[model samples]
Target chain A: MALCQTSVLKVYHAVIEDVITNVRDAFLDEGVDEQVLQEMKQIWRNKLLASKAVELSPDSSDGSHPPPIVANNPKSNKAANAKAKKAAAATAVTSQPQIGGSSSASSLVALKSSAGMAAGSGMKNGLVPIKQEVNSQNPPPLHPTSGAALLQKQQQAASSGQGSIPIVATLDPNRIMPVNITLPSPAGSASSESRVLTIQVPASALQENQLTQILTAHLISSIMSLPTTLASSVLQQHVNAALSSANHQKNLAASKQLDGALDSSDEDESEESDDNIDNDDDDDLDKDDDEDVEHEDAAEEEPLNSEDDVTDEDSAEMFDTDNVIVCQYDKITRSRNKWKFYLKDGIMNMRGKDYVFQKSNGDAEW
Target chain B: MSYQLYRNTTLGNTLQESLDELIQYGQITPGLAFKVLLQFDKSINNALNQRVKARVTFKAGKLNTYRFCDNVWTLMLNDVEFREVHEFVKVDKVKIVACDGKSGEF
Candidate 1:
């Protein structure tokens, strides 16, 4: 075909396939299991279609711009040949890390103080978007109304056969993750195996949602590989740790907000005294007093979830409600079934069995 | 499992030191130590905001020490390095200090 004439209709299937392959390899390298890998692939395919839908202007983005030829469907082309010479011309770009880290400790502190203020003052306006603007490099120039509409569209799409929203996390292998997470044993195993996995803790630059996916993927890989008895406990502990961290952040945020409100009021008071002729001081004072009371109440209030039911669902009928899947391994009979495990005080327990951490021996006894 | 317990103990000790330092420094009240410990991980997250280096150490007595260090903060257990230990120094309250890791008056 190339010898006959220069052709544009011929699709370079290899280029697109290479991109998909890269995605697959990255997820697999990150320890995603087969089922989850399939799920992620589906998400990526949908995303490719979505990206192809919106043709970005050259001015809009730099390296992440897709090829000029936008396919109505991402999977439409099935080209057999993509010459190595042409590959560079249509080289697929690796997307940058979507989530940006807080620049420094000082800025983070400022964010916390502001988060505190927002939570305390009950100021519903601009809190979320502002945070997003700060965190995202290409924070879709969204006005509040447009952002809301976009969110609504996403929710509707999610409701209609779409899977969980995709979470992307970048791991810095150079920096080990601080926590040590244990892995689950293999499915339908006869003997118990002890394989301790100390996951390199992902850095703070990675957000909670991304970290959750990374952890889940690793958990799946571990569970698939080993003959572990403490699969449920491991999941429970890790999830709870993240959950606990979130709750603590909320509490701290609330307290900081109250303090911020009080400080602002004090500053306002000092300013009002400096300008004694300002007649609106009385009205402002009354408003400040009300806000102060509310702030105080907010500061003292506990987090919304007192109970540690990770999913916080109140049903007992389904195994999937908790989003936790536990496989049982019977050593004697060599049988496996869905094992029932529950978390108490953030400790995972096998049903009808007490789990004890032997401090001296450093092994778990059930 | 023993590592978790050991980590917990070391964490507890670090937290105690942090709380005591804060209370002695009049940054936070003494009774709030329990509250602080419950939410110790937050401090860890905040401390991780800075550049840090961590190292793990082992001794003959089944002793494992984790150490963490940053430009402004250094946390250690059993003289080992805690690249992300999130512990108090002999006196600094970077990990234990509530709300921005700078003040206890709140």
Candidate 2:
């Protein structure tokens, strides 16, 4: 009796497995939407759980519990054979309609026989007593539009083959239709696992290029808005240092040139003064012609003074030109007034040029 | 990232790299000191307006000093000796003065 009960449990379990497998495959093949498939799977899972509870019940008196077998060894050949026979019968019933051309009458006979055997066994143990009651109380709802009507429609369309079904026209323009998306799954799992991704269809559903452009423009503007005072300050310092050094070098060069010119002029003046002393000594030697000597001495002295005046004028001109050049360069390079004040206050004016500074009273004093 | 506005190819090294490279490394010598001057000289005659003059003063030696102007820029070395200006070159240390009439300096 125990062997029989175990065999019956095994057979029921196998039937449940077959149903679950079929439902899963149908869901995949039909491209069933996830929400609908999830609801169907939930119902099937509840049914499976309930059936398992019934099979595993310990009380023999419970109407849902199968009969307890009295066999000493439940795994005997007889028990195995009975279980195998039940499985074969179940497979035959399922395969017949799927393979096609099994007459409706034969299919009905097989279904009735299985149903009768299950009912009879269930009644012996008082299991599933409410199943028949429920079936009688409420019949399965009929399709609003019958399957036969749908079949007729399909046939008519096939015969005509001129117009396509108008279902495509019902799609909303704004709706984001599902498209296949492949994304990498978490590591260490099987490589076959794919993440759920909902890709919008029709391409125009997303203005990807425009969105990217707007984002890029905003990023650039934000970055540009940041204050770069530190960097600017460092750059300005370096620039100012460079300019100051250049100005210094320039001043040194101008000073050296001026010194060379001044030294040459000094040497010329000393030579002229020495020549005058020699002419005086010659006049002393020829004292008898006094008027002639005095006339020649006056002539020589006038030319010497005139040459000194010309040299002074030349020196003044050189100073003026140098001043103009240096001032212009300083104004152009250090226009910020930060460095301008520094240059104006520094030793720049003393090289070869005359200093020019406006007094506090706004007087043009140089 | 730091940003800078560049004109007439005078942007130096250390400038942020970007599409601005076209305006920076395109013709500008990197690390050279340059003063920004506002001038409208894009025409052919303006093109021949002569190479922009840059006067630089540097310490030649302890007692020897030098002042020179050149169109080309050279890193560390004398501009007169460099002969050619690289797209990215360094200026050792020198002052930059804008010769144009616009008063505001860089």
What CA RMSD would you report for each candidate?
37.1, 54.7
Question: In terms of docking quality, how is candidate 2 classified?
Answer: incorrect
DockQ of each: 0.01, 0.01
Give the per-residue lDDT digits (tens) of candidate 2, residues A78-177. 4356557768988997787644532344543333233323322332232110111212222221321222221222222223322333322244434543
lDDT measured at residue A161 in model 2 versus the true structure, 0 to 100 = 28
Q: Clashing residue pairs in candidate 2, if any?
A: A1-A69, A1-A70, A2-A69, A63-A126, B12-B31
Candidate 2: Cα lDDT at A289? 19
Candidate lDDT scores, in order, read 0.28, 0.26
**Retained true contacts (fraction), each candidate:** 0.00, 0.01
Where does candidate 1 stray beyond 4 Å? Answer: A1-13, A23-25, A47-269, A273-366, B1-106
